[model samples]
Target: MATTTAPTTESLSDAVRRQSMAEAHTIQAMVDYRDAEMARTALIESSLRRKIERSAIALTIGEATGMSEARIQLRLSIADRVRDKTPQVWEAFVDGIIDFSRVRDISATIEKLHREESVARLENRVVGYAADHTGTELRQWLRRFVQRVEADLAVERADAARKDRHVAVAHGDDSMSWLNAYLPSHEAAAIEARLRKEARKPADPDDDRTVAQREADLLVGWCTDSDAATSAIDANIAVTVGADVLAGATPGFAESTDGCWAVPAPWLADVVATGGTFWHRIVVDPVSDDVLAHEYVGRFAPDTLAVALQFLHGVCQAPGCMVPAERCDLDHRIPHPAGPTTGDNMGPLCRRHHNLKGHGLLHWSTSPPAELIVIELYPPTPAVEMEYVAA
Candidate 1:
């Protein structure tokens, strides 16, 4: 029998690197394929329209590809936007510098500029930036950049966009469904913040529902139960707005707690003007971004330490979980009675993970004072421990 040589560490690393590059190339090829198909479809549709009277190109493409009309239209829109307005983005995509998702985001952001010149300007500024940032980061950067480019039109655009606001529900597999609301950014952020805050409250110690479940329940209850809906909107949302912007001296963006969303300054100013009574201002050090003071306006007073903990972690301490910490239960690494409820001992865990830790299905260890968390699933399956660095 011939002896087989084992792969060295260097060879293994090289193989992985090659595989990643291959995957990137494969993605780039797929994007090229999509663009070509879309171009062909567009040409055929144009010819058919001239030969006949009317042509449903998107529907025809959808039927041919087993895609819905909406999906076909969306894909065509992105392809056309990239091809016509931002060819550099398309070129970069084909070169494997960015993936399809980033390309789509670039296309969508460019289309939103309305003016071709504005779109061109933004595309010029963003194509290089997309290579280094993830899609989410790019979208956030686009928002701030748009404000810089079109400050005077922000309020008018917001008002126009608000007209398109509505709620949507979609079915999903496993008896789960998605509920989405397309609303003004400030209003939507406030609603999310309030739901998260309300989900943290439990009427009894034995309430076993997860925080996500509780939030869903709260939404349904608020819609159907008069008593639940009668309660005032009294949640403290952490918003970081520039002092000059808040004072109406300049135009900027107001960022939410988790940095996932931003609202134009003028739109936020309208919200503040009308609902000023419900707002509490938190002053932070401009250089260090540290909270210096909390000013309350309403009857509700949020725990400062709890807010600090939520801001510090931003998400659940559970491994591979992304549930916002504001919507999670503050868990003690050591059992609550034994472990003091101090910041050093407390970390946020969504209800399911909290139960897992409580029932010994999952185990987590923490380094005190600094509070570096390490989570491990039980049974030593692959023996992987995820470490969470405190922010």
Candidate 2:
């Protein structure tokens, strides 16, 4: 009590590790509690006599929890599925080795198998993997694994799913509307790629709209305005495929610059066979995965530099913003005339952030060697300072 000593390094490290394990255990316990609640909700919903009554249960749950009815229903479905078919995954969740997100992934993957034995097999294979990997990685692994295990059923399932595709619009506050589409991965990816490519076109110097705004405008124009839609459809999208894959020598996925989606080899072959247009081919060093050369494969001259930058950054360079670089304006870190239009000085910025920089509300500069952008943001009125680094 008279003289307290600082904790030893070994003791501090041990304490931190113990604390992390305790937090993980607490998270696992919370997930178990949620599963129990969801199971009870599902049991009650199942006992309801009418469909309307079941839906009302979801509505009540949503209202009480501040979640959408869709989310509540999804959780209930996962709980019922885990209780009925995939108890192994539930046990893993209960054991504190995996979290609810991984449980959801496993449940969803198992549901897609459509056979009891297949579901069991997939659950056995994926539960341990989920414990070791992030949810995103688990999903990617599951997709490839499912395709490998059920190649014969994949096409049939895809066709059935395709029949469910539809578009809808939901109104939001401030006169904004959200347009949603449930479409096949390839078609949706292609549409997004095209939209992003169109959005990257150079605009008038005075144009103040952000890349997102421009993309929304482009989508609306394409849908409702015939001329604009035709022109936009005429533009090409860049699909990155391995040379061996494109030549059918090896099977692989065709990916876009943003990496949001990957088209399966068979589907990609079909698209190419059925009047899919080719644009520019950008070859990369296979080992390094760095762009090496660009060759025009179609009549239009693609913006090679823009494509390179988009691939390198993938999203807006502005800190904390995730606008796809394909849908952003490539800005010179230094003014274009002041700084040469070179890779070292160029970066993508969405319209809003670009305008903010132009108006002197924000300032940024590129650092050499690492090619990191150091940004200092100054908010108005009370005046707040924030700094971020983008690499």
Candidate 3:
């Protein structure tokens, strides 16, 4: 009988090396091809020259590569931008520690950032981080990084984008319909968070609906019936901003603890000043990431220690987890009876991570405390207008 066996270790090693080499070569070839097409296009500078909108070069590459024109364009863009913005990321790709999939994602993120310096700083950080983390983890980190760095510009962009807020319904087969809402990130996050929270509450044992079904039902009920599922409408989320900025003494951005969105400082100040029940004050040390002070009352109050931990951590302590700290378990680092439940001894871990930690499968280090990986931001200088003197 003929039997098939796995390849030998040496053959397997050679195959892996060959695969990596091929991937690197493929990316390099694409870059060179795009450059050649661009150079060819540049030489035809007559009045009959094609407009940039005419993607003739892309079509030619698409036909050759058997990829869609749009796909080819996107791949070429990723190759070009990754090489230009962060040579380290390109090197990492060539080294085969990371692949083109990651390069495409990273390039898309960096494109959102307008400032050259911010792009360079982020590129430096993500190159090393991407080599270790999964795509989902990289995504969470990018969202937080971009939001924190472009805090001021983000506010403006959000304001502008709000004008385009909309909802649409698409009819489907079997009398079904698809509904979508294009909304501000914070508002959408809050709505979904609320639905998720409500859906998880203890329900009737006889109820056959899954969590998603429950959430959908609740959402429809709230939208169609004014009195439906109305225990509380406002979702509890965290926002951190500086008091100096709130008072208009200095400029800064208000960051959501969930890392989903950021807005101008004024929104937080308005919420707090207008007696927003859920909004509380917490003074944090930016340099050392210490929660120096806090204020709260009644329904807005949680355990003082818990609040401090949430403010300190902002997200789950598990590497790359994006679950907001407020929603996580306040786990003791050294365990309960042996470890005092102080700020230094406690941190937030999501349910899954908490289980892993409990089972001794996971470990956390406290060497570099605080979420403060200091990124120095350079503010744009004011443009000075010259006075025209009679000469």
Candidate 4:
């Protein structure tokens, strides 16, 4: 038998690998270009919105309508954001391609039209209308179009209300505590029996009911007679990690898969150092187990975590605040024990920034593995003195 050939650098595999690497680089460059372009567009649009607020209101009949300057400013603000999509669809409304009786938010309608149809259709409609309509006439027609859209939306809301009912039940005590009393045991038992009957039925392929709806209905039955397995789910986990890849880089927090976003372990030096940091609590979606929002409580340790606070937050990260890292908290950009605790995923936050992040006033959106750079400063403060001095 002939000896089997061993792979060598000269084989076709080397060429294919080089080509794949080239393609990946090209794709990354394109993504970077697109992001830069989006940033530029956003800046331009912001400037235009400010200009419209200053000038557009002057053209409107505000005094007769009793619309305050602030109200006019607000409308223009909304208009400016929607202008790009609105102008393109203005002709569609005038020509009756879009049913004015059913549409709302002309900008949103235009966007849908373009996406559902084609850019060619949008371009053609605008060109055809531009030849016949004046800018002032177009604006007037759009105002009426918006009114029809609102009426249609109201009809939709009413229809949905007739289809599904939302019942809010108050659950008292901590989340880990057993389900609170709602109605009498007999009433609860009756509801549970009905839920089981629905759960037992085979799934209907043609049924309009969503998977979420089916799961929700099943969940009602699950609430009855809790077991060890059910109790384990009741204890949600939380974890803290840094925003950067390396540990102790940028502090942040995220909830664990279980939906519990715990405070960083007090034993972790970073957690103990940030005096102003606190336990940010949140009730997550039971099904998705995603955090909804943070409810903050002061729970920081003034020692131990000092070095981590210094490392992650050189200063306060809030937009306008300028507090130092020493006074800040070690915030898990993603939070821990509840979520992944990585070095680069952390952020240092002063009291002001901590409040902002907890309240959703300021948000931390992460990028992919390599380009996870912070746009805003963490613990916005003056540069700290380097710990080691050259001899």
lDDT of 3 by residue, 140-251 (tens): 7886677667766766776788789999999999998999999765557557767887888899999999999998889888888855466654446666655555556655
Kindly report which residue stretches of model 4 are placed more than 4 angstroms away from their true locations once superposed: 1-305, 340-342, 373-391
Model 2 stretches with alpha carbons more than 4 Å out: 1-80, 83-87, 170-176, 226-270, 273-391
Model 1 lDDT-worst window of ten: 382-391
Model 1: what TM-score?
Answer: 0.53
Candidate 2 lands at a TM-score of 0.49
Clashing pairs in 1: none
Q: Candidate 4 on 297-360: residue-level lDDT in tens?
A: 2233223344665765678765555677777766665544333333454556787677766665
Summed over model 4, clashes come to 54
lDDT of 2 at 285: 48
Q: State TM-scores per candidate.
A: 0.53, 0.49, 0.63, 0.20
How do the residues 1-391 of candidate 1 rate in per-residue lDDT, one tens digit apiece? 9999998997875664465455445444444655565565666546755444223555655676677878766766676678678888777665656666777787767766766678878878887898778778888888766765665576567668778999899999999998889998768777777788778875577888899888888888887885555375556655676565566766666666566766665555455544322445555554476776554422222477679989999999888999999999877666533444457667789999988877777666654565466666664344334332221
Q: What is each predicted model's overall lDDT from 0 to 1?
A: 0.67, 0.65, 0.67, 0.42
The number of clashing residue pairs in model 1 is 0
Error of 1 at 357 (Å): 48
Segments of candidate 1 deviating more than 4 angstroms: 1-49, 53-77, 115-117, 164-182, 220-233, 247-253, 266-391
> Residue 388 deviation, candidate 1, in Å?
50
